[model samples]
Target: MKNFKILNNYSIRSKLIIIYLFCVLIPMIVTNSIVYITIKSNEVREQRITMEHAIERVKYNLSSVLDDCVLVSNHLHNDITLNDFITRRYDNLLDYYERYNYLLQNNVINYYYNSQHVYQVTIYTDNDTISNSSNFRKLTSETRQSEWYRQFYNNNEDMTISVYYDDNRKNYGINNTARTISITRKLDNFDKTHENILKIDVDYNVILNDILNEKMEDNLYVCNKSYILFSNKKSNVGTEEFDTIDSIEEKDVKLNDFFRFKVANEAWNIIITANEVSPLSKIVERKEILFGLAIFNLLLPTIIIILVSHSIGYRVTLLGIYLGKVENEEFSTIEYNDGQDEIGKLIRSYNLMVLRIKELIEVVFKRDAEKQRLELAKKQAELKALQSQVNPHFMFNTLESIRMRSLIKGESETAEIIENLSALLRKTINWGEDYITIEDEMLFVENYLQIQKYRFGEKLTFSFYVMGDCKGIRIPKLSILSFVENACVHGIEEVSHNASINVSIFKYDSRLFIEISDTGSGMEEDQLNLIRDKLRNAEIDMLNNSKSTGVLNTYMRLQMYCNNNMQFEIDSKPKEGTDVTIQIFLDEPGVSNSFVKENQNNNF
Candidate 1:
């Protein structure tokens, strides 16, 4: 359990190596070792059994071949007719021919010719009256000097096996020296004759062919003690005299097995020397192939495991890095090519979560900013109310007294001017309402323009145009009056020539359009664009930092009133005129008197 725990602690790559060693490499080595030992042992044992069977077969065939020759020789020796024919005195060649034809009819040699591998049957005798033909031969000086006859006479037994080369022989019509193996016996069954001998030649090629038929991958020798009587290799069969088995031994032949048997009173040996291949040669020859297979088995799996483990571990590590970044509040998405597997799905889900979180954070931040803006607007409203509370009753009474004094002094135009000034000051000092109908706001605009016209005299000309249906549309207080004040101060006061100011409030397509334009020494493009940018992007914070608080405040309030469904545009040309247009959809969502009322109650 402790070892298992330690193994678990190791990385996946190391664990895979351990698994290969134990599961594949070690087991394979043990299995191959056992298989090699068992196969080698079985191969050696099977070779020995095979060699034994082969040698035994060669011995049996040799014995059978020789036995057939001896059997034929025994028949000739015991035959009364054959004995009488060879021993009888013949008067003429015709009588001998007639008797020889009769003997040929019952010849045992003809019966055993193909069946017993017999080549020929010859009866040799020193009977001078008998003629020599195929079956009967006259023994002469040359016959006595032959190797077959010599070997037989030297054995000095009643019967013997003789193997020698007959140089003056023809086999199958081919004149060549051939090896002859035969059984020679003295025909003494019941005879009173000279030396009658029977010789039955066992076909040497047939015997050699029998040994060759074993189909063994080994060198075989059929030997008579020291002389090699037969060999499976045709070249090894003796030409003139039989070769000795000791010559084979001298050539460093590795003869490891022998089968000895008796045939015709002579011990013959079957010697087997293995071919150039070892019994375990198969294992030796395939050693390199086996080693390569082992390496392929080990290395292939190792590489596969490493690739699989790296693929998994690398993706998991990448996820870990992204997770760390997320923990640090870095809401960045995973910029990776995704797969269809479980881990790839996880990464895609994480990206989606990051996107949703970022959206929610933006919503929360916007809500907080709105709250701060409302609070600041409320404070500024309170400050304006406080500043407006500076002895307003006394100031009004003093203005009334001066206007009545001017009327009593018959300066009627002076009294009207003082009255307009006093009324304008009173309306400007009041902060009782945040939103009023366009009709009420236009009255305020007229008062402010009246005071400006009095200051500019004939140099300024101003007019107000309000559509019939647009008069009752509610808007933020001072939203239009602020722009009119800017026109009077910048346009009418700066120009030496007569400059005209126009204020138009009209409705088209359910939208309220308020346009304030002035014909005066118009502003440069840079100043116009600056002011336009300021008004378009107006915020509560600009009220504190910007010198143009009046215009900025008016734009911000109008935005809040229309719920940002308001558009403000500025069009101007140098030395020509300036135009400011604000378009708002009156019936849009949240663009209603109740929406402004709620804001007013909350702030005031």
Candidate 2:
């Protein structure tokens, strides 16, 4: 419990490192150690078993060679022709040679050709009839006392097998040298009276090659009870003695770290020494590599834990700082990173709480100030309404008095002008209404042109072409009239020649297009561009400063009322004319339905 409390006091990074070391690294090391030890134990047992089997295999192959030699000797000893050749007495030496040649061809050569390992087969006899021939020789006292001969004679068994070095060039006049394993047996007549010797020499190198080919890394020694007969190591063949065994029949004996096994029917033992390092030494050699791998395994998890813990802890610390700010009543919102994890959600929720709190506090603190602002706005609106109400009424009444006076004085043209001015004033006052129909706007434009025509006399001529159903298509009030006024003052008035103004309204699909053209003094390129730039930027102050307020004001008002759904453009050239176009998209259901109804009524 105390350790747990201590761990809790540390940061998350340290805690993660400690936990990974105990939970992941320690267990992995323990498991690997157990597995390595188990594998080493199995390897040692397998190595020992493998060496014992090798020794047995060698023993079997050597026994096979010795058995073949014994079989050949037995066959030779029982041959009647060989026994006759050995015992028969002949008078002439030449006659004895002929008989010996016959025996050599039919008996000795046949045996030699039949056996794969037998290098030669020979017979030695004490008889005076048998001369030394290719296959037989007289048995001398010196030959009978030779080491191999004595060994065979002293055995007293039917046959004896031993390995000795023989030169075929000196013994049988063959072109070969071999370490040979010889099998010797005593031969007797059919009556079992006298005896001769039959010997079969087998190529020991051939037998050993077949048996010991696979055990190149091991040392094999074939030894009898007294001395080593043949060995893979040539230096030890004649000099090495058989190590004393506690039991002659010991199957597999471990002596001086070498394994020894005895041949089945012979006194010989096959000693095998494996050319392999001890298991413990191998483990020690690879200890550094294992340690390095273990360290890398532990370090990999440590790094990953450190990185993850740092990320989480950093985000949490940032959240804490934001919370502290809130506690101090700063009420600032954190810049949300838009992460979708738990921390992101927490930050978003905290920002929402701060916004709600800010809104509540604003309401509580600024309530009285907001009320005063509203009261002031109300008074200003009333004053504007009073000014709007009294001015238009006074202007209308004055214009009516002037029209009556002119009619009474027989000035009917002047009276008609006064009436047109009063109508324009009334339309201008009604501009406070947000929207007016195309027909109402067109009527206002006509009234405006009448006043201009009266002023210009015969110099100003105008035409209106209202194409398609344009009656109830609602647009911002004063949108069309402002451009009409511009055409009169700038386009028509400046040209000295008689000028014409054309106002065209047409509907194409769901949009209404209006064009106002005047054949008057148009602007230069630079002046036209300047006016265009000012209107495009909705620079009302700049336009008023430059005495081009009407078009700029109309453009801004159209933008404000139409949410910029209307298109406005002005095209002009010096002394030719000016064309101003306004395109209004009629996509709203209220406006479209009103226009459709108005069109139906007109058609009916």
Candidate 3:
């Protein structure tokens, strides 16, 4: 009873009221401002989107109407009874012609001359002018002469885009105030006895009504090339929608790119405005209630909250440390406790997440590069072994030739072969990164050509031109040299000195292009096909060999470093020449000019 008296003091009530005012008022001001701004932004975005979609819907409606008009015109354009109606003689074709006009007037057009049913078409012939219909009839009709008419006449009476004050206005005089968008196209030439122009006057109101008077609970307006066609503002039709009738600005909004264009392609625009107070008013009410509740119940809840804050001081400190680490994005370690309290469980879960993140960082970022380095070392060794075998084979083969020549009546032409072979062997065993400057690689090819020239004697000739800016560019080991060796082995066996090799490297438009041409027995289509199949299957062996062993290992290494869009082109003709084109993108992806990850810390 004494503690209750202490808790019920005026000082405690005043403190609680101050706490409530500070806490609730700050949050209310902030929350209300934030809520107000967020809702306004979203409303703007949603209104813009809805406006764009509404404009599209309007265009679609207009386009559909135009399509219906075209369908009717196309049918009448090929009509058979049209010729009889234009001749102004209702013979055996009156019923057929009346039916034609009826089909045209499905819901839109209702005009004819010598048309038995509705409004009349007036025409002036060389002899007389006449128009006769059920509701509207004329006897001495003056020729329909106007600038609009002559434009159609000179255009072979094809079509004129015009609007009408009324769909029922067939000629010069009509009292109706309503209007329509229409097209008029001639069915045949004026000289012939055939149907003249087919006139289409469609009601544009139905289309405008659907979008302009939409029940969106938002105001929508639509504009055309000439005027604001309609709006929900209770303005009259044909009222221009915007004061700025400039071209439809691409409002930087995401829009669907489908254009169901209306005839004459009168591009339309839309603007949307939604009611603002509806959404935000609720937020305002919520803030008021929360603030009022905080005021009324202020004292008791505050005393209880203060007691809890003092009791949980240590736990709050621990949470603050953990939150600091999280803000720094360093989750190397975390604290855990065995207790089943909410705070204990939270710390335990957080520690588990930190361990999982460490493992994922290892897997996601580091594994691929480690695997590549190991595979690269293995391939280099394997290729070196294979390259070692080549030297001995060529040595034995050349010695055998020299012995054969010496046994006969030779002047030691084999001496030249021995020297060329020695130079080729030394260059081919490049013991470094699979890359070398173009200058170094060309020297290797020169030695290869010397060997080939010795073996084939005067039967083979070689010419190489390393062109502008291509001299010192780095390429994979043996790229051109290997091709020279291949040509020596395959092409020069049959032809004479005309059987040539030309190594030309020219840098063009920031790319490295190599053309290796040989003039011996060029490959057949079948052989080229076989080679392409082999090249396509080049990656399959590496993918299949889990051990990552290979011949042409340098080739595979270069390919791995190239972009996916890198290319090789082979052109050949039987007995002419074979041109092997290798196009290397200098800025190829995954193949940086400088070592980007060179200084990556050894984070063991």
Scored by lDDT, the top model is: 1
Model 1 residue runs over 4 Å out of place are 1-39, 170-177, 234-242, 250-263, 275-280, 284-604
Residue-level lDDT tens digits of model 1 in 1-604: 2222333234555666766776588757865675566576777677778878887787678768777676666666777888888888889999888888887787644665655467778889888888877777999999999999999999988778887777766343222337777788888888855888888877777777787787867677877765787776664242456787786754535344444334455666667766443434565556865587567666766765665455456667888998899889898888874445556677788889999988877898789889999999999999999978877888999999999999999998778878888887787787677777788888878877777777788888888889876666668887898988887777777778888999898878767799999997788989888887887666777888977677778878888878889888888887677898999875577775664454355341
Question: For each candidate, how many residue pairs have backbone atoms clashing (under 3 Å)?
Answer: 0, 0, 4
Order by lDDT, highest first: 1, 2, 3
Q: How far off is model 3, as Cα RMSD?
A: 17.2
Model 3: residue 30 alpha-carbon error in angstroms: 23
Q: What is the Cα-based TM-score of model 2?
A: 0.38
Quote the positional error of residue 83 for candidate 3 in Å. Answer: 18
Off by over 4 Å in 2: 1-391, 508-511, 533-547, 556-569, 583-604
How many residue-pair clashes does candidate 2 contain? 0
RMSD of candidates 1 onward, in order: 45.2, 38.3, 17.2
What's the best-to-worst order under TM-score? 1, 3, 2
**Candidate 2 lDDT, 13-117, residue by residue in tens:** 566677677658775786568556756677657767776776677667766766676677767777788788788888898888788678657755475547677
Would you estimate the TM-scores of all the predictions?
Answer: 0.40, 0.38, 0.40
